[model samples]
Structure formats: C-alpha cells, structure tokens
Target chain A: MIVHSASIEAINKDIHPGMVVADATATLPALKVYNYKEGVCEKLLAELADWAFRFTPVIAVEAPDRLLMDISGCPHLWGGEEQYLADVVAKLKQRGYHANAAIADTIGAAWAAVCYGRPGQIIPPGGQQTALSSWPPAALRLSPLILDRMHRLGFYKIGSFINMPGTVLRRRFGQQLLTRIGQALGTMPEQLTSVLPAVIFQERLPCLEPIRTRTGIDIALKTLLEALSKRLLKESKGLRKAIFKGYRLDGNIQQIDIGTNRPVRNVAHLLQLFSQKIETIRPALGIELFILEAPVVEDLSAQQESLWTALGDSDANTELSNLLDRIAGKVGSAAIRRYLPAEHYWPERSMKISHSISEKPDTLWRVDRPRPICLLEQPEKIEVTVPVPDYPPMLFIYKGLIHKVKKQTGLNVLNANGGWISKRRSGITTALKTNRVRGIGYSGRVNMTKETLNGIYMDFLHDSYEAV
Target chain B: MGQATEIQENVVERLRQEILAMQGLRVPLENELRDTGLGIINNAFPNQTFPVAATHEFISDNAQNGAASSGFMAALLRILMCKGSCLWVSTRCRIFPPALKAFGISPDQMIFIDARTSKDALWIIEEGLKCQTLAAVVGEVQELGFTESRRLQLAVETSRVTGLIHRYGSLPTNVTCVSRWRITPVASIGEPTIPGVGFPGWNVELLKIRNGKPGRWQVAWNPDGFKVVQQPKVIEHLPARKTG
Candidate 1:
C-alpha cells in the first residue's frame, strides 16, 4: 500500500504522500492512514464550483483543489476588491474550508499570487511583473521538471530570470519557459470556460430564513418577476419564455417553465401562466433562494404595439392566440390546431393543419358548389334497387335502414381522381362513365307517393324521345 | 282601523301592477330571438328565432345520425361564431374538420379537446362553458345525465356562452336544455338536368321546446342559408314517379 495524501501533522512527523505505508508506519508507529478513493476530489471540486456561483456569474474549476472566479466588475457591488476577496475567504473559513484568494490582471498572475504570496493579495492592474518578481520559480506554476531544471541552473527565484531577455531564454530552454514567463507577467492572454453560460436576464432572491409555505413561494416569485420585468422593460425587450427555479435547503432544485405565443412583458399575464404549472413544483424541504430567468427573449420595439391596434386582422389574430393559450393551459398544448387551405381536389386533402396560428394560407377554400356539411369518415356501402340504365334508385338500404326515394336531384359524377366531372349526363353517357365512377351524389328528400307517378314519368320520357 | 288596512292593501296592489308592467316591457327586449338565417325554421322557436345564450341538446342514434347532427350544429355555429372561437370537447372525434367548410365555419375557428374518458370530457365541457371568451362549447359524450346537464346549464347561465351537447348512442331523457332537436337524413331533390346530388336535406324534428310548440320541418341547406321545403299533397292522377 502507498500513502496517497497526509495531513499537516503527519507531514511534520516525516510522513508524506507517495511513501510506502509500511515505512510510514515504522517512522511513526501511530500514524493514521486512509486508502484514497478515486474521483472524490473531482466531485468535491464540482460541488465547490456550484457553490461559488453565488459569488460571481463566471466560475471555472481548476482540478485537484482550486476554483477561479472573474469578479472584475462584480467586486464593486460588494464594496471593492479587497473586501470582496476577504468576504469570500471568510465565508469559506466559516464553512470549515482553508482557502486563499487573490485578484490580479491576469489569470496566471492571480493563480501564482494566491499560491505563494499571501492569503489575500490584490495585485494592481499592470503590476504582475513587479508582484511576481520575488516569488520562487515554482510559484510560476510550471511543471516539476521545469522547476527542477531552473533550480539546477541557479534560477531558484523568479526575480533571477525577471530581467533575462526572452530570445536568450527561448534559445536556452525552448518556448515553453518563455511562454510561462510571459503568461505569469500578464503578457499572454488566457481564457476561462465557465461552468455554465451566464444568463443575463435573470433575477435572484435569497431569503434570510428558509420559507416552507406556498404563499411564501408565491411572493418570492412575484418579486423576482417584477424585478426581471423591470429590467426587460428598460432594455425595450420582451421574453418569450421564462423559467422559475427554487433552491431548497436540502440541496434540491425545482423549476417551472412557461411560454407565451408572443413576446410578453406583462408580469401579470406571465404570472397567470406560471400559476397553472406552479403546483407541479414540490417543495419538500424549505426553499432558501428563488431565481427567475428568461433564456429566450426578443426585441420588442414600440412600433409593434401600434400595429396591434392599427389593423383589425392583427387584432383578431392576437385575440385568437390569447384564447388558445388559455385553453391550452386547461386541456393541453396539442389540443388546439389551425388549418390552412391546400390546393387539392380531394375533400380530406383540401386543407392542411398549420403549425402556428400566424401562418396565412396561399389559397382560399373552394365555394363554387355546396359541399356536404359532414362527410362520412368512410363512405357507407348501400344496396340500391334501380331501373336498368339511367334511372335513380327507387329504394336503398344504408346502415341497415331502408329508404324509399321519392325525389332525386342533381346527379354529380365523380371521376376516378375525386374531381367532379359533370353535373348531368345522358343515360348512355353515364353508363360509359360508370367504369371510372368514384362516387355518386343522390341528395334529395324521401316521401310516400302513389305508383301512378312513376308510369307518367316513363310515358313522358318516351314521348320526348319519339318527338326528337 | 279597517279603512287604514284597506288603504295599505290598495298601495301594495298598485306597486305590484307597476312592477309587472315594467317586467313585461323588459322581457321582450331581453329575450328577443337571434336570427339563425334560416327562415321558417327560426320561426319555429318561441320568439320566431334561434335561442342564444342557452343550452341545446341534439340526440344521435347512430353514426349517420351523428353526422347529421354535427352538420346541423356546424351550420348553427357558423352564425353564432362571428366574434369568438369555439371549443369542441369529445371522447373521440369522428367528425372531419374540413367538412365544416360546407357550412362556412373554418376549422381554424374551433379548438378540439380529446379527453380520455366521458367524465373528463364532461368536466372539460363544463369548464369551457364557464369561459366567456368562447362563443360556444360543444361536447360529444356517450351519455349525459340530468345532474350533469343541469350543471352545464348553470355554467352557461353565468357566462352567457351557448352550449351544444351532441349525445350519441344514448336514450334521450328528462333534461333542462332550452330545446331539443333530432335531425335525420332525407331523400335529396335535384333537377333532372343536373346530374350531381342536390343540396343537403334533413327532416328536422323539434322534439321539445320550452314554452314553444313542437313541430317538424323538411329543411335543406342552400348556399345562402336554410330553405324550408314545401311538402306536396297526394294526387291520384300523377304518375308513380314524378320527374321535374
């Protein structure tokens, strides 16, 4: 077994990490040791990074045991840089954590200052060179090999190489050493990858005491929304979507989100939408913080407001969309749909559903002829008894019910493609079109009449044909 | 003492008569019928027009009957839904949305809610009826009892929105609807020169109307509006089949 880490007291007794456990025990018979568990340090670092978000919006976790925060413009809010650094170190100390914090113009310089200079050091802007001159070469955060090489070359202190020419150093030890020197002296730029993207249109409310009631949550949400809406109004923008997140005392977060059909700046309307979904958030433990964030925002100029009332079409469209949102809140978002007319002859394919209400159809519905108010989902098959060639059915049975036809009207012949070919055709021509006949239109009323009427119609047709 | 008592009674009777006259004047103005654009069919109601801000029940015995009822309801909705959208809550929607175009009601003007059960459908319908923003609420359920119908009526009473309940495959019973209707498909009439089917026709039966006489009419939908068809009398001299 090997010793992975040791405390300060163990180090004082000549016990160090990477030493054989047997030897360490022999050196100090009562030395306490623990087996190292993998990934424990990484997990703790991630947790610390999350906690550090309360201090600044930008936080980057440096592995093993470090966190970098860029509190450039944020420190003034906490009463200046010195007090801000002191406040952070004090808070960590209160939490039983030993931490060192430093502020400088560059990341490398700040890291070096925090590691070697003092517990709390504030390096002035453009003062990295002078501040880092007296530190040891190891304080530059170079690799162990580079530090050892520099020590062997009699460059134990950073001041020893502070005045050296870059060209000479580059020729002697390659570009790495020069680059390290440049980075530590603020000549090189460095970038930090934040743990999460900063949300600009966000407001946070931290409670002095944990709140556990629904009314408390409602009040907190209202306050945050008010503040956020004020900021949005000042910027002349509106949010399309907003999320409310509550941080509980037990380290759990509950969030509820709401979306609007248009960019909304009204807090009351937003609160109404949120009220519908706020019950889903289970506040098992007491909540200590509430945050309202708008990740999706749009530029809402004043001119858009004028267009809303200037045109009647736009007014009705907005009203319809608002109604849809309210109904969706009750039923669901998928329950509502809008359709646009499509260019098709088939009844079912004549119109298509639109994804949103704002879309306009290219073609209007065909109103040339009157269509049925309700078309059967599927055409029902009927048994019809008709005369041989071109006469309408005298009797038909549909859905197990027999109907005697007393009168028949317009005869619309549908072609195979579902298009109406002609309204009326001769009996012989209708026989030819029967092969391609897709549908028949037999719309009329049924009445009980004497059989003598049928004979007269037959006689009349015979007389007309003979005269022609 | 008898004279004083008689004087008090006379004053009370005078006040009562004045109030009755005022109520008589207000009733005609407030309960005026809304023209449904159907000529004689509208006259069949109590006020010679269709009922507005009231609940109407339509019974469908089968799929074909359901189709006919929905079509008739769509035609009524075309006139009612001039300013607001409509809510349609159904257990399973069997009516094709595009078919409503024939009645001049666009699919965009209606929002459909597909509920999981008849109970949920009724709840949604009641909630929709309470919303004044909607012009009308249509619920299609297999069965709706008296209590549920009364609750729906009460909701509409407050919101003043019309409610059309299409009951399918259920026997009609006692309910508090303003009126009840049953529509069945009838043999259509077309000109001999016109080969296609003529306009849609229905045998509209007003089974029960509150404070109005019950009647039946043969109505057909024209492009403009509903036209009442005149029934021809029997004449022995005519042929077995009459062609016009």
Candidate 2:
C-alpha cells in the first residue's frame, strides 16, 4: 500500500484574480522510479525549479516526482489541460523522466488521481474521494514503514483506509500520517512549503521577422538592453557582464559576451559598450529571438559616487582600467598583466605578473628604492674579480657591458609593510624575510642553532662608498 | 671630396646622438604627473572635456581586429574624454553603441571610423593626430609596420598631439613611438572598511620613452582617473643560498 500527496488551486473568495494554492508535499519529487529517500528526494526536487518551468511558471515540485502547477489560465497555450498533460509527459520522457499528471478541482483529489487513478482522470470540483478511494495505499507517497504498518493492520487500500475510523488510524500511526491522508482526500486543507524560485534574468526580444543584418541585431540588442536596464534599476542591481545569445529558427545559439568595468544599469551606457562587438557576430542564418542575460550582478545604488566622481577628474586610472578590460577581452586577459612586487629576494622571483584586475598600485608601492636601472628578468652569472670579499668591484660586466662604479653602494633595505597579497597556489609567502648584501661576495648566514633554517631572506639597502 | 666627408661626419654625429639618447634616458620623476589636473576627471572626461591636441600615443604589437587594440583605445578614450573631445578610428572590432554608453563616455563625443584595411587605419590615425582640436586619436590596426609607425611618429611630432596604435602582445620593433606601454592590472589594495578593494591600477613599464628610463612603474586607477607612482621597492638580485 502506497500513499500519494495531492494539489489544488482555488480562486480567492475576496480578490477578483487572486488564487489560493495548496500542496501536501511541495518539496518531494513527483515519483519514485528511482530509489531516493524521502528527505533526499525533497532536496532534489527543490533544485529542479528551473527545469520545472516547462509546465508552468507557477509550478511547485511536490515531494518525490510530483509537481503542482497552478495552470488556471496557462494551458490554453498548449491547447487545454489534457493536451498540456500529454505534451508535458512527452517532453519529460524525451528528457529521460517519467511522470503522472492530473487536473482536479481540489488539491487533494488531483494528488489521488495522479498517484492511483488513471493518467487521464479529471476530478471535477467536489469529486475528490470519488476519485481517490479506489487508489492503493502506496499512492499516498507515505513512508514505506508506515504504509507496511497500515497494511499489517489490514487496511491495505486507500478506500479501506478511508472507511476505517479516522480516530483509530490516528491512535495507531501518529497524526501526520492520517493528516496527510486526510489532506490528499479533501478532508483537510493542505499547505505547501515553497522552495527558492529560479532567478529569471533574461531579457527577450521577439522579432516579428528574422533579423539578418548587423544593424538589425543592434536594434534588437538595444531594445532588450533598454528593457533590462529598467528591471535592473528597479531591483537596485547592476550588470557587470552579460551574454547576448541569439536564437535562430533552427535552434542554434549564437552568443556574444560583453563586460563592464563597473556594474551599469544605464541603457545608453550598456548600448555603447556592446556596439563594437556586435559587428563581430554575423547573423549567420538569421536570428529570430534575442536574449540578454547578465551572469554577474552587483548591488548598485545610483547615489553611490562613480569612480570618476570620487577621483575628482584628475586621474587617468579609470581610463586605463577601461582600456585594460577592452584589451583583455580581445587578446585574452592573460596578455595584459601588471607587475606586482613579490616577497622573495631573488631578482627573477621578485616580481609577479597578474591579471589586470587583481593587484592595484597604491601610494606605498611607489616608495623609492635602489633598483638596478636595467634589471634582467633573470640574473646572468658573470665572471668577476673582486679586490677582496667586502669591496665593491672596480668594474663589472653585465650583458657584455662593463661599467665602472662611479660611486659604490652597500646594501640598504627600505622598511615598510607589504600591501595586500592575494591567494595563489604556490609562490613566496608574505611572512618570509628579505636579506640584501651589496658588497662584492657579501654573505651573511644566520646561526643554525637559533631554530630552523626554513629559507633565506635578503633585503638590499642603498650602500654607497667610493671605489678605490 | 670635402663635401662627401662632411656629410659622412654629420651622419655619424646624428647616429651617435640617437644611440646615446636611446640609452639611459629616464622619464622625469615628476610627483605631480600622477595628479594630471584638478577638476579634469569628473567634469571633463565623461563630458568629452579634453582638447584634441593633448592626445598621447598607445602602442600594441598586433594591429589585428579583436586584438587588444580597440580595448586599449577605448580605455584611453575614456581617459581623454575626461579632459576633452575624442575621435576613434576602429579598424578591427565593430563598435557597439550600447557598450560605449555603459562605460559612461558620451556617445556624442565619439566619432567611430571603420577602416577596412590597415593602410586606411594608419592614414586615418595620421590625419586625426594632425587635428589640433581633438583630444585624442586611436588607430585600430592589425600591424603598425615600421614605415607606418615612422609616418605616424612624424605626424605626432608635427601636430604635437598623441596618437595611439592599438596592437597585440608583440613587442614593438625598430619603429619608435613616443611611449611604449602595456596595460596590466596591478594587485588591488585590500581595504579594512571594504573586504576586497582594488580600484584597478596598472603596472606601466616605459618600454620605450624618449626621455624616460625603461623601468617598471605602478599607477592606481580609480573612477576619478589614473595616478602614477614609483614601482614598489623590493630586494634586488641576490642568489638563493643552498640550505643543508
């Protein structure tokens, strides 16, 4: 014996176009073709809200595989409720799913019909028990343990359970089981616990005729942006980057993605950002539908000062970032990188190149230091003859250029706190020390007895002495 | 015989000067350069404020379409609009009207010329550079060939204006532009008030400067604008010691 939940929609007694919705098990998946536990089944159905939209926008997936859709005025698009149910079943089968759908006047009767009654039964407003009594106990979607106990009690079918004293059933299985049965049979009102609904961020442009030209695509995109901008503004959200996908009658998706350095909800600004890239997309075979979706949205308060406004117009930084975004979009973001000073002392390892958005140059990064006029990416080992261990070399060759030190300088370290270091997989740790010894063959080693020799730290300070 | 020797001597002097000037010239350390000007960013840029004559050159290697050139130019145009008016010659990517608006740059201030070929792009850039009334000229091309760079360089010198050729990642060849730069994002500064805050700054290397040493520099980019500072001081070349 199995128990199944039911669903129904009723016009509000007070409001003209308002409706009341009820579901016995809103989180449960519709059916158990696959063995999913009651709790896990509920979770899985909740995640399928996006996919459930195929039936109705007002769809709520009941526990297990059941879904209650308030299709009051929605089914005319599918040519009425019976045809709608058939079409839904066909579509689900195409997507590798099995479902039982029914239409009824009360939520409880609809649940009974879909679970135990035949696939096509339509329960008129007051016919809940007439439709539900003949179904098996298993149709109620109750816990198998409870269903087995009810069977052992000799109440094997839904009609038997209905005929037995409701008081005796309550005294036997706890109140929830009987209440679920009563709710499915229209004896009690059912309540649904709603899940997080799918977020609909798409802006659609349905062209009366196919758009084949770049200009036409531009017009369609502009129309969509205008519409979407208003929605985003109303939501106090801004789009930073969006993908514009064009759908051809042949079902091919042509997508072009555009990005904004800052989140924008202004229609004009959004239009200008995409104008050039739109030419890159050929209408190939023509597009009949256009959809713009912003995958990333930011909380945008229009009152917040624009970066340009905050900087007060004396800065080129905003302009430069916009340029970087454009270049990164075309040549790949990796091609444009800013040099960030690393914590290591090694010349080659002292700097790292990261994507333009990661590290920002601050006032402290500009602190002065004695850096080689021309620092090679990698230090080339050169043969040098020093007068002694602690003396600056009179002459040294680098890249085959021998330059005599006009003024000699010993190591000097600029003391300051390191700026923000981002999380990367493997690199120099920020806590590492830097040791710089500038004299010829300068070597300073810490005592091994101090603790542990994790790694070497070198900091070069400006040491200037006259070369003899 | 005297005239021929004199001509050879003059050529030698010029070549020597060029080499010496190319080597060891450091960009002047002007603390004020980062400031640019006051009231310039907020009032001028979005309103198309800068005059055309104050433009600067932007160099990228590949002039091809969909290369970083247009993006590079757009960013600069965004900056130039901070100060004045701008004309952009787009050879590679199609200009979308909506994207420009999204960036907050006035659509009315921008005139986009689509050049079918690289030759046409260079010619347009050269002409735009010569116009004193425009704030900047961005030439979108696939390759700013040596000859093309020389011609554009001459135009920049004559107009006393900036002309940027948007190129790809390839380093510039023998052709000299006023300044060679690559736009990369600097590490954003983390803020105590705000968790992850980096107002986009650039690690700008003066790859080739007429009067500046080619060293790495960092500049913070804010909506207010770009501000340059010296690159962070780090320990110079030192060998890693082998630990026992």
Candidate 3:
C-alpha cells in the first residue's frame, strides 16, 4: 500500500504521498498508518461547512479540503480581517485540525494565499497581483504536469514571469496557464454556489401585547401578510400556499393557512382571503408571536400580465382569481373544482377535475355522446325480471316505481383496448342480460321518463372474452 | 279626449322608469340590448329583456325538477356568460360539470365551490356577486330568507353579474328578486321505438315577475339554441318577438 497522506513528522522525513508504505516505514520505523475509508474527506468538509455558517451566510464547499467563503461583508462583525482570519484558523485548530485561512478579493487569490503563502495571511483587496507574485506557479491552481514543466523551465516562482508578455506566455505554456492566472487576478468571473438550497421566504412579528381579541389577531395577520407579500413581489414570485401561525402564551400554537388556485402576491386579496379564516383562530389566553411562511412559491412573470392579451382580460383574470380566493377562504379549497375532458369511456373517469384557472383540457369534450345532467354517486340496484334471453328486461322496478321496458336498447361493455362492443361476451345472455352485471363497469344507457343513467359496465364471469 | 289618454300613458311610462331606476336596473339603449335567446320568454320580463344583472330564483320541488332546473339554468348561463368565467356554489354540486358542455358551456370555465352548509353557500354566492369580473354565479341552496336574498341583490347592483339561485326542495320565500321561476321536467318528446333518453325539455313557468306578463312555455334546449317546443298564442304574442 502507498502512503495516501502522512503527518507533518513523516513529511519532515521526506515521506510524501505516492511513496510506497515500506519505503516510508524504513524512513521512520515508528510511523503510524490507518486504512483509508472512502468519502472521509467529503464528510469532514461538510461538517466544517456547517460550522462555517456562523461566519457568513454565503459559503460553498469545494470537495476534499477547501472552504470558499465570501467574507467581503462578514469580517467586520469580528472587528477586522486580521482578527477574523486568526479566529477562524485558531478555532479550527482548537478543534484538533490544522486549518489555514486567507482573506482576499477573489476566490483564486485567497486559495493561493491559504495554500502557498504564509498562514493566516490577509491580502489587501485588489492587491492580489503583488501578493501572489512571490508564490510559486503551483499557487495558480494549475495541473501537476504544467507545474513540473514550469519547474523544468527554471520558472519556479510566479514572479519569474510575472511581467512576461501575454503572447510569449501563451505560446510557451498554453492557454490553460493564462486562464489560471486570469482567474487568480480576477480578470474573469467565477461562480460560488451557496450551501443553502433555496431562499426561505419567512417573516416574524412579535406582538407588543398579547393579542386576545379577534380584531387584534386580524391586525397581526394583516401586518405579517403585508411584509411577506412585499418581499415576494420584489422577487417576481408569488406564493401558492402560505401558513400563518400564532404562538400563544399558554404554549398552545394556533395555525391557519391559505392556498390560492394560482400563485398570488396581491396584499389586498390575500388579506381578504385571510379574513375569512380569522374567526377560526382562537387566540386563547392571548398570543405573543405571529409568523407567516410561504413554502410553495412560483415565478409569477410580471411581463405576462401586460405583454399579452387585452387590458380588460388580464384585469378580469386577476379579479376572477381574487374572487375565487375569497370563496376558497370561506369554503375549503377542495370544494372548488373545474373539470377538463378526459378520453375515457367510463363516465366517472371521463373527466378530470382541475384546480387552476389557467389549466386547459388536452382532449376535446365529446359532445357526440350524451351524458346525464345529474349523475348518481352510485348506481341503485334495480330489480329486473326477464322471461327470455337476448332480449332486454321486460320490466324493472326503481325507487318503488315500476318502469315498463317497452322500448329496449342494446347493452355496451367497454374494454380498455377495444371500444364499445356488443354483449356477445356474456354466456348468460339467454337467461338474464344483467345477470351478474352488479358492481362491474359497463355502459348501459337507461332511457326513463325523466332522467337517464349512463356509463354502466358489465363483465362476464363465464365468457372467454371477459375483458371484451 | 285623445289628449287626456296620451297624458295618462306618459305618466305610466314615467312611473315605470322611476321604479326600474330605484331597483338599480340599467336601462339599455337600442344598441346595448342583449338577446337572451329565450325566444318568447323575454316577453315575460321587465322592459321585454331578461335582466342579465339581476337575480333570478329557480324553485325545484322534486328530484326531477332539481335536475331540470340545473339543466335549464345551464342553457341560460351559456348564453349569458358572454365568453366570461362563471362560479357554481353549493353544499354539494350535483350538476355534472361535463353535462354543462352539452348546454354549450365549457366545463372548465365553471368553478364549483362546495360549502359545508347552505348558509355558507349563500355567503359565497353573495361574495361572488360582488366581484365585477365574473359573468355569472349560480348558488344551489335549499332555502334563503328574504333578508339574505336582499344582500345578494345588493351585491349584484354594484357589479353587473347575473345571479341564479337554484333552491331545491324548499318552500319559496318572499325574495325581492327580479323574477321567480319553476322549471319542471317535461317528458322529452322522442321516437318511441328508437330506444333513447331523447332531448331535454323543461316546462318553464314564470311564477312571478314585476312590470311584465307571467307566462309558461315548453322549451327544448340543444347546443345550437333553444327551440320553443309549443309556441304560445302566435296571433296574440306577435309583438313580443319584435319588442324582446
């Protein structure tokens, strides 16, 4: 096994990584070693990142051993950059880790200062060039092959070619060397993705007095909503769902939430929606805190309101949403339904209920087929008496009234692959047309005096083509 | 003697205008008049025009009537929606949304709000009426007192939205509405041997109306439009087809 990593004492003995374990053992017979486990470096870096959150909200973890933090506005809290850098490195060392930190304007410059320059160095802003000039070409974060080539060319230090003409350096060392120098010198932009996944839109309001009355609760809710909506509007986002919670003095938490059919940021409309549920929130014994959180937000394009459609249409659209929001606030939002056509033969599955106003049907509603105006939630079992086979029931009784089968229609059974086919799949057609049709899906359109029952299904237990 | 009769007729016309104005009804000019496509039924409404901005109550006393009233109102809403959105509020929405397509109204445009109680349904309906954006609001309620309906009427006055209250299985209350109607199921006329449920027909009865005739008519509704099943008094009601 090779030495993956070695302590400073082993390094002093010239035992470096990639050296055979036996050679390292010979150099120091008392050398210690441990088995290498996968992903240990990454786990340690993540824990360090979690600790780094106390310093700055904007921080990223570059895998293996680098913690990049933008401390442009963060160091002042610890008095100055020197103390901040010292405290950071000192605190990490106190955690039984040998940590070095460097503060600079650019990520590359700071990385170079931390890795190659003196420990706990603080390079002045915009002075990355002078600070990095003393370091070696390895400080520029170049590949090992390029560093070896530079070493062979007798350009060990970066200052050896600091003032070299751009074309000359480009021809000799290639474009990668120039790009690394450019990145360190802040000539090109680099991105730092934050540790936090997404921004949380939340607002808190602590009441000066414990609000006991409904009016007081309403005021608190409105105040929090206004502040939250302002932040949402500035970001060009709207919340589809939001929660309002009140922390009571008695340690009881009362919470109410509102959901919009679509994303909304309008304060007045949101207030109106919340007003409907204010009565349900019992501020029992008084409440001390109120919080509004919007967990589900979506980009509400501001241009879409003005760029397309006529002026009256967009206005009416918002007004309609506002109106629906109020209704949803009063009744549960589930009660509100809008249906789109679905391409299915079973009546219950024929339509899809949509919640949003902007949803459009993918399939056109079939007008050729007749549907009932009022559909029964469940089909009532009717008593039918048949005298012979292959004929419709002679008479049927429903709801205490007997319906005489003067004119009878054919029975239709729908298969998923095949469209409506005849009832030839039923072996008992001679005995009873609806012998075992109970609780199965079949389309049997009944023509009665006033109402029609449609979308009935019949499956045969004894026939070979049961599905058909 | 002829001058005296003209003076009396002018006085009657002035009084009619005053009453309509007090009720917050807008008098449409000749070009602004909208045809409800109800054929002669408009003859039974004030100013010979179906009040699109007013509340119309439909009383259904039986199961069939409940279904028929919804079907009949769906036809009216199709014409009155003016390509705008609609709201249907109820305790439990029984009107099959797909069935609205049969009446030429797209089901997607109709939002059904299910309330836990009839009181809540009416409240939602009143709030819906106050919004000027909606073209129509249909509330399925079992009962509504006179005071509650007046609030609904007041809501529509500020916003020119048509409100249809389909109250099922309840005694009719004295509501200060523009009109009251009872739509009963009429056995659909079809070929007996064809074995089909046939076309939907309603025996539409105008039980009450102010400043107009109260009449009943048999009307059959289809996607194309309404066909007056039995045209009433062709010779006597000739003026209605023109004025309405």
Best by lDDT: 3
Candidate of highest TM-score: 3
Q: In lDDT terms, how accurate is model 2? A: 0.52
Instruction: Compare candidates 1 and 2 on lDDT and give the better one.
Output: 1
After superposing candidate 3, which stretches have Cα over 4 Å from the reference? A1-196, A212-216, A284-286, A304-311, A385-394, A405-411, A415-422, A427-431, A434-439, A442-468, B1-11, B29-32, B190-197, B233-244
lDDT of 2 at A113: 81
User: Which ten contiguous residues of candidate 2 chain A have the minimum total lDDT?
Assistant: A447-456
Q: What's the distance in Å from true for residue A128, model 1?
A: 35
| Candidate 3 residue pairs in backbone clash | A389-A430, A441-A457, A442-A456, A442-A457, A442-A458, A443-A456
Model 2 per-residue lDDT at A191: 52
The DockQ values of the predictions, listed in order, are 0.15, 0.04, 0.37
Q: Compared with the true structure, what per-residue lDDT tens digits does model 1 show for residues A143-254? A: 8877888889999788888788989887877788878778877787678889987558999999998878888889998999889888887887888888999999999999
Best by DockQ: 3
**Candidate 2 lDDT tens digits, B55-140:** 23445432121222233345456655655445566554344322233234554455455556676567667766765445577665
**Tens-digit lDDT track of model 2 for A1-468:** 222222222112221222212221233334222222458767766666557676676766765667777667777999877798788778877876556778886566677687677876777777766676777777676788888888887776677767667788778887877777777766778654334455667898888898999879988988889888888878878887889989987888888887765566767656766774787776777899899999898887756424444543322434444443454354344433334545543333454554433244331121232222112222233323345433444444333544343333343322222233232311221111111222322122110000001111111222221111
The complex in candidate 1 yields a DockQ of 0.15
Deviation from truth (RMSD, Å), model 3? 17.0
Q: Is candidate 2 or candidate 3 better by TM-score?
A: 3
Model 3 TM-score on a 0 to 1 scale: 0.67
